[model samples]
Structure formats: C-alpha cells, structure tokens
Target: MSGINWNECSVDFGEASYPYYFGEDCLDRIVASMAGYGADRFLVVTDDNVLQLHGEKLLPALARVAPVDVFSRPAGDGAKSLHNLGACLEQAIAAGASRQSVVVAFGGGVPGNLAGVVASLLFRGVRLVHIPTTTVAAMDSVISLKQAINSTHGKNHIGTYRTPEAVYFDAGLLSTLPSKQLRSGLCEATKNCLAIRPQSIAQMRDRLAAGDLASPQTLLWLLEESLEAKCSVMAQDTYEQRAGLILEYGHTVGHAVEMCDQRLRGSDGLSHGEAVMLGMLAAARISNAMGALDDAAVAVHEELARALGVGTEMPGGLLIEDVMDVVRVDNKRGYLTVSGEEAAMVLLGRLGVPLGSHDLPLTAVPLGIVKEAVATLVPDNQ
Candidate 1:
C-alpha cells in the first residue's frame, strides 16, 4: 500500500461513513486494502459480462488475500431479481460462507445492489465492499446507501439500506465499456444537473459540447460532480425518503419505462439512465403543464438529453398503456397520500426549486397528468 497513489475520500452519511479509494490502474492496492479487513473468505457478487471483462483485475488478487468464491449471474438488468437473491444467499451459505466473510460487489449497479442485498442478509449482516466498474455504479449508486432488487410488480420494491465497508473505483475499467454503456450513466449525471445541482448545468453543457465523453479528465469531473450532488442531499436523510428523494428526480417514470422496455427487448433496449433521461423530459413537460416549470427549462431537458446521446422518444414497440400499468404500482405510493388516480413524484417548480414541502420534495400528481406527459415521448400518441 506504500507505493499506491490512492485518491482517498470518504462518503459521509452524517451518522455513518466509509472510505472511497479511487485511482487509475490501482486495483491491486484497492484489493490490498480490502484484504486488510482480516476476512477469512470473499464472496464476489458479479455478472457474467463483468466477470469476463474485468474479473482478472480483481479476482486473482483477492484469491491471494483470502478464499474467493464467486456467485455470478448472466450479464444484464435481468439478473437483479428475487430468484438471484435467494439463490445467491442459499449458495453462499452452502459454500461455507461465515459471518466473517466479505461480500464484494464487483461490477455495476446491478451486481452492486445484488451484493448489497446478499451481504445485508448473510449471517444477518456481514461486511460489505463495493468495487464499482461501471459509471452508473461508480458515480451514482455507490455514492448512496440504498441497495435493492426489483419486485415482480415495479422497480426497487424489495430492498433495504446497507452501508458498505468501502468503495474502490478504477476509472480505467470504464474505458472498455461500449459508447452506449458509457452514455447510460451520463444520463443520470444529466439528471443531477437538472434536479439537484442546477448551478452546474452550464458546466455540464460545456462538457457535453466538448464531446470528450471518455477522457480521463472528463471521468474525474463526472465522479466529483456526482459526489457533490448526491452527498449534499444525503447528509440529512440517509434513507432517501425525504430531501434525498430529490436524487430521484427522473426515477419515477424512468423506472417504470425502464422495466417495461427491458421486458420487451431484454438487454438491448433503453439503458437505465437513458430511460431516466427520457423520464426527466416527461417530468419537465408535466411540470410545465401544471404551470410550475416553464418552456425554456423543458427545452433544456431535451437539449441535455440529445447532447448526452439520449433520444427523447420511447423505445420501439413499447406501449404507453403498459408503462402506465407499471406506473400505477409505482413504489413511491406509500410516501404520500395519493388516491388511485394519482402517483407520487418529485417535480420542480423551477430550476433548483422543488415544488413539494420541505424534507420531502415529493407531491401527488394526477395519474392523468403522468399519462399525458409520458405520451409526449411516444412516437404516436394516437
């Protein structure tokens, strides 16, 4: 660890915190730090694609540190499920996992979340670590404490909060990702600009306009901005049921649309962040119709999405009716008092200003409004 040029930082949750070690081509030192935890075994949770692409960078080093057991599912959003959760848990137990075992989430958000759930449940709570390889996990999901898998009905319905022992990121891994995969996380970064950190909007526009989406400098700025936006909101509400929900600006309709499109096209459809970007566009329209958000702000959403390489339209063959069906069962229903005709959402009255009460930037918008806004993304509303 002496020669390791680690860019050490901390993720502060007020009541809880953990070390986030970031560096270029430093997976070896990162693994050394994880080994310092004095664990007898490592349960590496990852998907097939990540395992194939980047496992060598992590797994061999970990094998030298402790006994490594990997529980891998096929790559894609499909792996985040109750079936995988149950199987991963039961298999870890059968494989001699003990309370002293460390659950290493070794991929993007899908595996990071699956590992989080497994680690939270194993031996009634074991030590957990995150080594995020994807931009979404590194810049967005790992910065927070929320860990979840999708329910049969909607998004993130089955999940809980769990703090990680550490988060290790090597930006070099992101270079191998496809252009589409990279843009997926940029969409979430765009949402942060529109929702929480409005002041950074111009900076982001400048960055996108430069067209250096994969440069080392751009990646560093992306990670820095994400930490600032997510950590600033999470300091007060660790559970994300309050002000932290602002982090979910485009997630409501985004999650619903993502789940629906994934069902139709499997892994080839809209990426999670793309759907969220589209959701932000719809949300902008919804707020405009309600006379809260104006037209120029809505245009900004479109411009950002287009510049980030996201389309403003829905996926081909996806139905407004199916997306609406999932929105009805949106997981935010319990947060506020919404009748069957309404859905709970986070909307803005203007840039940098949320429309709801303090503590919870969430309000009840009629399902009809939600439908109309979403329909604008469809190629043919008729």
Candidate 2:
C-alpha cells in the first residue's frame, strides 16, 4: 500500500451510506479494507478473463483475510441471466457460505450486477462489496444501488436496488484494457457531461484528444468526474425513479440499439457505451426536431462521438425498425404517460439542463419522430 494513493468518498442514499475507496496499484489496501468488514467468508463473483488476469494478484490477498469462494463465468452480457444467477447462488450455498459471508463483485458491470442480485437474495441479504476492475464498473455501475439481471424480454427487467457495504477499485487495472473497452466507460462519462455536468466537456475534449487515455491521471479524472455527476442526482433519488431519471439521458434508445445489436452480433457487437453514444445522437436529432436542442448542440454530440472513437452512425447490419421494436419496451416507459406510438425519453433543452419537471426528467415523444431520429443512424446501404 506504500505506493498507492488512497482516496475515500461516501455515497449517501438517505436511508444508508457507504464508503468508496480507489487508487492506483492499491490491491493490497483494497484487500485489507475488505477484510475489515468482519466476514466469515468472501464470495467473489467474477468472469474468467478477469480471474485469469488479476485473480492471482487479488484472490490470494483476499484469502489471507477470510475463506474465499469464487463463482466465475464466461465474460460478456450473456452471463447476466437467470440461469447463471441461480448457478452463482447454488455455488455459494454449496461452499457453505453463511450470513456473515461478504459478496465481493470482482469484475465489470455484468459480474457486478449478477453479484448484487446474489447478495441481495442470499440469506435474506448479506454484506456486499464491489471490487470493480473495468472503467465502466468503476465509473458507472458500482456507483449506484440498482442491482439486476437481464430478462429475456429486456435488460435489467428482473432486479432490485441493494447498496454495497463498500466499493473499491485500482486504476492500475485499467492499463490492460483494449482501446474500445477503455472508451466504453468514457462514453458513459460523456453522457454525464452532456446531461449533468456540461462544464466538464472542455476537460473531456482535451483528454480525448491527448490520446493517453490509459494514464492513471486520465482514468482517475474520469472516475472522479463521473462520481460527482452521478452522485449529485442519485443522492436525492436513490432508486433512480424520479429526478435521477435524467441519468438515463441516452439509455432509452441506446439500450434498444444495444439489445438489437447484441441480438445480431452477440458480444462482438457495439459496446454499451458506444450504443449509448449512438443513442445520444438519435436523441439529439429528436430534440432538434422538437425545437428543444438546436443543430449546434446536435453537432456537439457528433463531435464528441468522433473524438471518443465511437461510431457516429448506426451500427452496420442493424435496421431502424429493429431498434424501434426494442424501444417500444423501454424500461423508462412508466416514468411518463404516452400513447402507443410514443416513447418515454430524456431530452436536453441545453447542455446540463434536461427538458422536464423536477419530479420527472423524462418526456413522451411520438414514435414517428423517434423513427425519424433513428433514421439518421441507418447505413446508406441499408
């Protein structure tokens, strides 16, 4: 821990609060901190790739503190299924895990989500800890209490909100990530800038162009900025049901495009952040048509997308209809009342200002207009 730069932050949920610790090259400190939870066992849920890459460095340190049991699966969104959730539960039970067992999520969003459900359900809820490795997990997923697995019909359909006892991360781990994987989290951070903290846009633009994304300074800045942006909203609306709905900025159409692309290309498809970036483009177009967001704002979205190296257009082999089909069942629907031809979405009136009331940061836009916006993403050949 000598070389590690320890930074501590707290998440206040009104009902509960917990600490989040992060630093570079700090696995030792992380393990030591997790041990202080006073658990009889550690149930580590992770993916095989992470296990192979960082497990030896982390698991051994954890085992020294308490009995550790690993429940690992293949990497990707497919692992977030009811089947795998059950498998993780059975594995924990078979390992003789007790009520004092600490469920430590040891991967990115997928494993973090699955572990969250497992912890919430096991023994009527146990202490949960998140040891996120990926930028997406470190900056986005682990910051909130929403825990869930994807349903066959939609993403995060079967879920609950369970806060972790603590969250920890090491920025050093991100150095090994491929460029696309690194950009995935930055893209989510980009959403935060466009919707929640537009002032950070200048810093983000500078970093994106610097082309040294893997440096500890850049990763730490992204994490801290994301924390400030997301926590500012989530602290008031813990479940992300009211004012926090603004966080869903591009997710409405983005999630739809993401699911459709997954159906077409599996894990090889567009990343969650890339899809969200594309969804922002669609949302910008929709906003412009509604005379809420001007063309200049729309162009800014494209500029950021290009700078982030995410696709500015819709993914190949995907049709506008396919994305629309998924959009019809978007989870944000209940946030507002809309006709059958309208979809609930978060639109921007200007940078950092979402176009809706204080209680609900969403609006109902007609399906025809949604289609018109999505049409911009369609490939010329399609």
Candidate 3:
C-alpha cells in the first residue's frame, strides 16, 4: 500500500465518490456540496460548544450560499434525546425551514445524529448535509445516515437510515478538537484498522504513541483507510441486515453496557467510543471463552486499544449478571431470541481478518475468568 499515493486513488466504497477532504480549506468543500444540490435556504444545527469555537468560521462560508439559520443545544450526551429532537424540530419550523431547505449538522456525533434524525422526520424528508467536526464522528457517526434518539430502554431506540445528501469531513478540523475527542475518534479508526485492515495496525500504533495528532499526511491516510473499510461494509449491509453485524463487532455488548450505565443515571452519559472499547474487550473475552479467539490475539487487541486512548477497562464495579441482562434487551439482535445453545459473537481471529460471527458458548468461560478480565480492564484495578 506504500508509494501508492492515496490522493490519486479512486477511493470509492462501492459508491460514487464520497469524498474526504483534508486541510484548512476543506471546509468550503461542504458549502460546494450544498450548492450542487440547489439548496437555497440552510438550517444549521449545532451545540453551544462548537458554536463558540468554529461556528463563526463555518457560518460565513455557508451564508454565502444561502441564508443560514443557526440552532444550538447544550453539548454532550445529554442532548441526544427525544426532547431535544422536538426542540430542534420546533426551532427548524419557527425558522421557516421548509422541505426544500437543507439541514447542515456542524458538530460531533450528537449534533450529526440529532440533525440527521430531524432531517429524516422533517416534512416527510428533507435534504441533509453532515459536517462532522470531531474525530469519532469522522471515523463512524459522521459518514452514516443512521439517526437516533436514546430511549429509557436503550440507545438509538428511535431513528432511521436516512442517508444525507452529502458528508464533508475537513481533517483540518482535527486541529481544533481536544485530545480526548481525538482519542474517541481513534477508537473507531482503531476498530477499522483491526477489523478491516489489520496489516497497518502496527504502523498506526507507532504513530499514535508518537503523538502525531496534527500530521496532515497521517490524517489524510487514516481517513481514507477507515472510510474504505466502513463504506464497503455499509454497501453490503446498508440496512444493517445480517451482513452488517460485522460493523458491530464490539457494539453488541458495547451498546448494552452504554444503556445499563445511562439508565442508572437517567441522563445521556458514557462516551460511545469509551463504551465501545469496553464492549470490544467483553466480546473478545466471550470469543475466547467460545474458542473463537485465542489469548494472544485478545491481548493484542487490548494492547492496541490502550495505545489508541480508549478506556478498554469496564466502568464501575458492574457485575457480569447485570451486564448480561442488558445484552438480552439490546436491539442489535432485532429480537430477543438467544437459544440455550448459545449465540455466535463476532470476533477477530487476527487483525484485518474478520473471524465472522459464530455461536459463543458462554458457559465454557467460567464467571471467574470474565470477572478477572473485567477487573483487569478497570483503570483503578490496574
């Protein structure tokens, strides 16, 4: 893959040119995409934090194309709810946004997911553009059309697969992103690196350790790699049918843990990337118990996660029983139908080599082993 310049590559993930523009000037590319769609009026959805930071820079660029109406919400996990969705919809209507108007999501996963959900539900449907600012958004939430609002039951309980008309990712935005947010995005990129292209994980690990966060060269390369893997998987499983479960390698248990914690607090809490890291650890252990993955491979997976800045350690002193209970209610299965014979958990036999899904015999792995793994993952315990 070396010496072959990615800038010249036809990096189509089975779609016609979903481009990832890098550098400071790349933000304008998002405006150009809206113009291409004949958008005359733009409704921008973001949060207070991003508005204070980059909105000034992005708004003027967008206003040049259409009169831009900005809507802001309190940032963080608390904003991804049915109530906020309603508020945003109210604001959108009050602002005179019509079906012909375009909605631009100008923040991280929360804003992107929130605005995306609004676009899908507004006026039956409206054109939407995603301008993902955070790295985690760049690696996952920013590119997909999946929009969701968390429910008392679980995360993403209410949502749809309404793909945006276009996604504009300016890697230069990474410069403004905080280190933790950058790390969050890297968890997804790390997941892609391991699941789709294990060949480059070592090199990526080195770069991360060296704190090469601002390298335009590295950002450009990593974005292309992650997009290639994720888009290919999405193409084969656009509706998240069976084949798409591959993308949920760590998400099965990840979503459950996230919900369990959020339900206990009655608020949107736990960073998705952090939750997924723990979920990946849990899945790896489950796979190990089922004989799907060996100790060596699991160790390597955990090692890469640590280097990438994901808290692979489970949060709190949660018992295995409580976590498993949440797993039963997870919508990822689409149905509560796990047989006594055991269900297959997706795992990686080796980096870049998807082991596919297989029935994991949980009984095979003693509760003590899982507890030990959990304890070992807790930062305090470590």
Clashes of 2: 0
lDDT for model 1 comes to 0.88
The Cα local distance difference test for each model comes to 0.88, 0.88, 0.68
- Which candidate achieves the best TM-score against the true structure? 1
The residue-by-residue lDDT of candidate 2 on 262-337, one tens digit each, is: 8888778888898899999999889999989988899899999999998888778888887888899888777799
Task: Enumerate clash totals for all models, in the order shown.
Answer: 0, 0, 5
User: lDDT-based ranking, best first?
Assistant: 2, 1, 3
Cα lDDT tens digits, model 3, 213-319, are: 66666666667777777676666456655554566667756776776666555334566777777777876776676576788878877797778776666666555
lDDT (10s digit) by residue, model 1, range 104-211: 999889999999999999988999999988889999999988899988888888888899999998887887888887888898898888888899999998988999
What C-alpha lDDT does candidate 2 achieve relative to the native structure? 0.88
lDDT score, candidate 2, position 315: 72
Weakest 10 consecutive residues, lDDT, candidate 3?
A: 1-10
Query: Which candidate achieves the best lDDT against the true structure?
Result: 2
